[model samples]
Target: MFKDLLKTHLFPTSWCPGCGIGGIMAQLAMAMDEMGLNQSNSVVVGGIGCTGRMAGYFNLDSVYTLHGRTLPVAQGIKMVNPSLKVIIISGDGDLASIGGNHLIHALRRNVDLAVLCNNNEVYGLTGGQAGPTTPQGTPTVSSPDGSPYEPLNLQGLLKTGSRYFYARTTVYHQVHLKRCIKEAIQWPGFAFVDIASQCIENNGRRLGFKTGYEMLAMFRDKYKRAPDGVESLAPLEIGLVKRGEEQP
Candidate 1:
C-alpha cells in the first residue's frame, strides 16, 4: 500500500546501518503518498551509485540505468508520456560529475521532472574516492593528503536561467526533505533538490565521525535556512543562489 510504500521483502537494504539514504527514501515515499501519486504513472529513475539503489526499494515503477545516465532516461520517459511523474534519484557523483552536461541541458530545456541528488561528498559506491563535490582538504582514497581542488558549486551552476526550482535539505531534516520533495514534484517545470546525505561507511569514517548519528548531528549543526525561506547548505545558502533572478 502507498501508506507503507516500501517493499518489505527488500528489508535490510544493502545500505549500511544508520545510513541517511533510508531517511531520504522514506521522505520520498511519504511525499508521493501526500501527493496521491499513482504508482503506475509515477516513475523513479536511478543511476549507478548508492543512491541509485533507491529505485529498487520502493513499490513504485522504477528504472535503473547506467552511471550518470538517469537524467536523460527520465527525460525520454517524460517526453513519451507527459502525464507520468518522473523523478531522477542518484548520487552527486553520478549526476553532477559524469552526467553534468545532461543535467544542465535538461533543466535549461525546462523538462518536466524532479531530481533528488544525494550529496554525500565522496563517491561512497566507488571505494571512497573524492568526487567533484568533495570539499577541499577532505582526504579520500584519491586524495589521501586531502583534496586540492575546491568543491564544485552544483547549485550555483544551476543559477543561470536554467533551473526552474531548487531546494536544499539534509537527511537529518526529514520533514523538510519531504516538504521540498513535495514542492518539487508539484512544480510545473524542472525541479532539483540537493539532499546532503551521509555515507557513514565511508565519508563519516574518513571525516572522523565514528557513527552515523554523529554525522547526522554534524549536518544539523552545519546547515542553516536562508532568510529567503529556502534551506541552505552551510553558509552558502545554496537554495536561493539565484532565487527569482537569472544570470546574464
Candidate 2:
C-alpha cells in the first residue's frame, strides 16, 4: 500500500543481509500509510545508530539528531508545531543507553511522539558490543565471559506513568508489528513501540542462530498471545497499556 512513499533509489540497503532492521523499516512505512500520514506533514527524527539511518532512507521530513538526543529534537518539533506528527526511530544503545534520561523525561511529560526502539540486544554498528538491552549473561565482544548486569525492563519503566501507550513486538510478527505501529501513531500522547529486531551478522551469530530467519522462527516458537487478550508472551508483555476507564 505504501509503494511510492519510499526513495526507491536506495533499494538494496546497506544493512547486513538478513538484518530485521529492513523489515521493521518497511512496516513503519506501511503503518504510516494505514494512518493516511504522508511526508507532507509528518516528521521523523533519528539518533545515531543503525536505526538512525532510517531518516536518510524515508521520503519525509527527517532530522538526523545527535546520539541519544532524538527525543529532545522530536519534542522541540512538536512544541513548535503541534500539527506535525513526530516519529523517532533509534536503537537500544542510542535510546536506552545514551539517551535514557531524555526518554524518561519524555514519557513523564507525555510528549506527543511515536517512538520505535529497535532493540537488537547488541551495538550492531559498533562491532557488536553489548548494549543496554543485552540480556544478562549474553556473550559479546565487550562481555567475553558473559555480561554480569541485568537489562533494563523498558515496559515496566513506561508503566510508571499511566497516560501513554506502549507495546513490544518482534520483526517475526510483521502483521502484529504493523498494527502496533499504526495504533502507536494514532494515540494522542507519547507512544513507544519496542521492536525486537535481529542483527544476523551480530546478535544472531552470537546467539547460535545462523541467520535472521532462524531467529524469527525462534521468536515464533517462543512467543504466544496471552489469554487476557491484552498481553502476549514474548518473555514480556506485548500489548497496549490499558487505562482506568477500560478497567472492569
Candidate 3:
C-alpha cells in the first residue's frame, strides 16, 4: 500500500549514491499512509535544492517553488484551504540561508504546516558550498580555508523563535524518524523536523566518510540518545524538545 503511493519513475535517478533523502522520503510516505492522507487532500511544497525534487516524486498535490520560498508558499496553501495537509520539504541551504526569514516568521506566526528540513550540512545542490548550518572549520567549495563561523543549531534556534512541535532525527534512526514525522503531522500549528541527512557525493568525499551508508552509521552512533539523566552521556542528543497548542 505504501509503495503504491510513491512516484517510482522518479527513482534510480538524480540523488547521489547512498544519499539519505530517499530514506527520509520513504519514512514520509509511511507516515502519510498510516494517517490515511490521500493525494486529494495532501500538498507538498518544495524549495530549490535536492529536497525540492520531492514535490515531483510524490503522488500528491505539490508545488516546486523558488529557493527558500517554500515556507510562505506552504503557508499560503494552508490559508486558502485550511483543511489541506501541507508539508514543506526543504534543504538547509534553501531553508536556513535563502528561506531563513520566511521560516522564522512562519514559526513565529504558528502557521499550520509540517516543515521537513534535509540538513546535510553543506549545500549539495549547488557545488557543495558552506551553508548556514555548515559546521565550524568544515571546508567547502566556497570556504576552502574552512568555515569560520559556527554552525547554527536549528532546533535551538527554533526554540527561541517559537514554541511548537520540534524534533531532530536522522535517516539512520528509521523508527525515531518515522515517529517524529507522524507526531509533526499530528501536531497542530507549525511543526519542524530537521532530518540530519548525508550528501555522499559532496560531503562524504570531503569528510573522508567513504560512502553514504558510512555517514549514516556515523550519525547514528554519534547522535544516538542516552538514558535519561545518565551521567556522561553523549554531548549531542536528538528528539522532541517542544509541543505547541492543541488543535481546535
Candidate 4:
C-alpha cells in the first residue's frame, strides 16, 4: 500500500511536467516504506522551495516552515522528542542559500537528522534563479550571462564534523538514490544526501535540453559509481562516502 503513504488525491502535482522532483519524492516514499518510517515515528520538515512542497504530499506528520527556518524547527522537534526521526526535505537553494547558516551550525552540532536536498542547481520555485549549488558559468535568470560564483561544496561542508555521512546521487540512478536515503536515515549523526536532479522546465530548456529524458541521459553518461572505501567522491563520481556509526 505504498499509495497510502502519499496523498494521491493530489494527482497532478503542482510541479511542472517532466520535473525531476517527482522522482525524488517517489524514491523517498519507497525508502520510508521499506524502513518502516510512518506517521507515528517520523516527522518531515519542509523548507520553502519547490522541494518544500514534498512535505505536504506525505501522509506522515510534516511541518512546512519559512525559508531558512526548516533546520531550527527540526532542531526543536529533535530536542524535545529525541526519539522521533526528524527528516528534512528541501532544495539546494533552501538549504545552501538563505538557510545556509543553519546548515553549517547543524552540521557542527551533529544533529541527528537526515537532510535530503534536491540539488537541481536552480531556484525552481522562484522563476529559475541561480542557486547556491549552481555551477560556475551556468546561466540562470539571476545569472543570465552565466553564474559568476563557484558552487558550494556540500560534501566538504558535511565532512566538517568528525563523524559524517554524505551521499551523492542523481534521479536517473533510482536504485542508488533509494539506498542513499535508507542509509542516511540510519546514520547516527548528521546525514545528507545531495541528490542531483533536473529542472527540465526552467533549467533544461534554457540549457538546450528538450525533455527530462535528455537530462536523465546526461546524468547517466556523466556520473559513475565511486569505488568502495573511498574517502572522498570525485566530481563525476556518484556513491556513498561515510565515516561514522558503522553505517548503523
> Which candidate number has the best TM-score?
4
Q: In terms of TM-score, which candidate is stronger, 3 or 4?
A: 4
lDDT of 4 by residue, 1-248 (tens): 66778998987899988888899889999999988889999999999998999999999899999998889999999999999999899999999999999999998888999999999999999988998999999999999999999999999888886788899999999999999999999888889999999999889999999998899999999999999879999997999898868643
User: Which prediction has the highest lDDT against the true structure?
Assistant: 4
Candidate 2, residue 188: lDDT: 81
69-107, model 1: which lDDT tens digit per residue? Answer: 998999889999999999888999999899989988987
Deviation in angstroms for 9 in model 4?
A: 0.7
For candidate 1, the per-residue lDDT at 232 reads: 34
Per-residue accuracy of model 2 over 1-248 as CA lDDT, tens digit each: 68556776888787889888888889989888878888788988989998998888888789999999999999999999999999899999999999999999998888888999998899999889999899999999999888779998887777777575778888888998898888788778888898888888977898799888998887777666544445323464455563332321
What is candidate 3's local distance difference test score? 0.84
The residue ranges of model 2 lying beyond 4 angstroms of the native Cα positions read 227-237, 244-248
Model 3 TM-score, all chains together: 0.94
Task: Give each model a TM-score.
Answer: 0.92, 0.94, 0.94, 0.97
True-structure lDDT of candidate 4: 0.92
Superior by lDDT: candidate 3 or candidate 4: 4
